[model samples]
Target: MKNLKQLELLEDVLENSSIILPITINGKRRSEIEVAKDTSKNEIIALAKEATSKWLEEKSIIKEIYVPNKLVNLVVK
Candidate 1:
């Protein structure tokens, strides 16, 4: 299984009010989606997972990362 460090990092970033969603196309990152600070972690993760799954179905890929205050960084890929 892939190591999803973002699960742990989400806890830290949730308090900081920002979440990073990196969208990749054909193994290359194309853009990033940022969640506002007021967004709930569960909501963010659910949305990200849905988006990632949809991207995978479309032959693309996406990974969600949560960086909190630049102190800790976690990635889903």
Candidate 2:
């Protein structure tokens, strides 16, 4: 995913995958929803998309969905 310097774009991907990505902002994950990319962005985004697609396609598999607490949404306020 291209860094927007703000990560809101990841919201959809995270929602669809039902998984939180762990990001290192200021050295710690704001919650636990940060995506890890060790190589080219193209490769990383593709990987994330692939994983999410697989999770969606596997209808029988149950994935855990974690909703961030209210406090986590307070940073902008």
Candidate 3:
């Protein structure tokens, strides 16, 4: 198990190992998504968007995908 902020090679990330990544809206923590350690950055972003869509305002936009910190930030009107 890897702690948050610990950097590791993708090859060493196993499917069975997962983490709860933080999802933020306008720099505020909003939701969380459990994803495999091997999940790609794009996939993590998609999951964050889906998980937070309900509370997302109209015309909301994803602003950042910071994998190192396991955080997905969104911009909302």
Ranking by TM-score: 3, 1, 2
Task: Give residue 5's lDDT in candidate 1 (0 to 100).
Answer: 73
TM-score to native of every candidate shown:
0.33, 0.24, 0.68
Report the Cα RMSD per candidate.
13.9, 15.9, 7.6
Kindly report which residue stretches of model 1 are placed more than 4 angstroms away from their true locations once superposed. 1-20, 23-34, 55-65, 68-77
Candidate 3's residue-wise lDDT over 41-73, tens digit each?
Answer: 888888888998887746657465565536788
**lDDT of the candidates, in the order given:** 0.50, 0.35, 0.75
**In angstroms, how far off is 46's CA in candidate 2?**
0.4
Task: Select the stronger candidate by lDDT from 2 and 3.
Answer: 3
Give the per-residue lDDT digits (tens) of candidate 2, residues 8-66. Answer: 76765555553334422223333333343223444443443344443335343222322
Q: Judge candidate 1 against the unseen true structure and give its global Cα lDDT, from 0 to 1.
A: 0.50
Looking at model 2, the pairs that clash are 21-33, 21-34, 22-34, 23-34
For model 1, how does the per-residue alpha-carbon lDDT over 1-77 read when each residue is reduced to its tens digit? 23467766776676776656664444455455577656665666565555556444534224444443221112333
Best by lDDT: 3
Better of 1 and 3 by lDDT: 3
Off by over 4 Å in 2: 1-38, 54-77
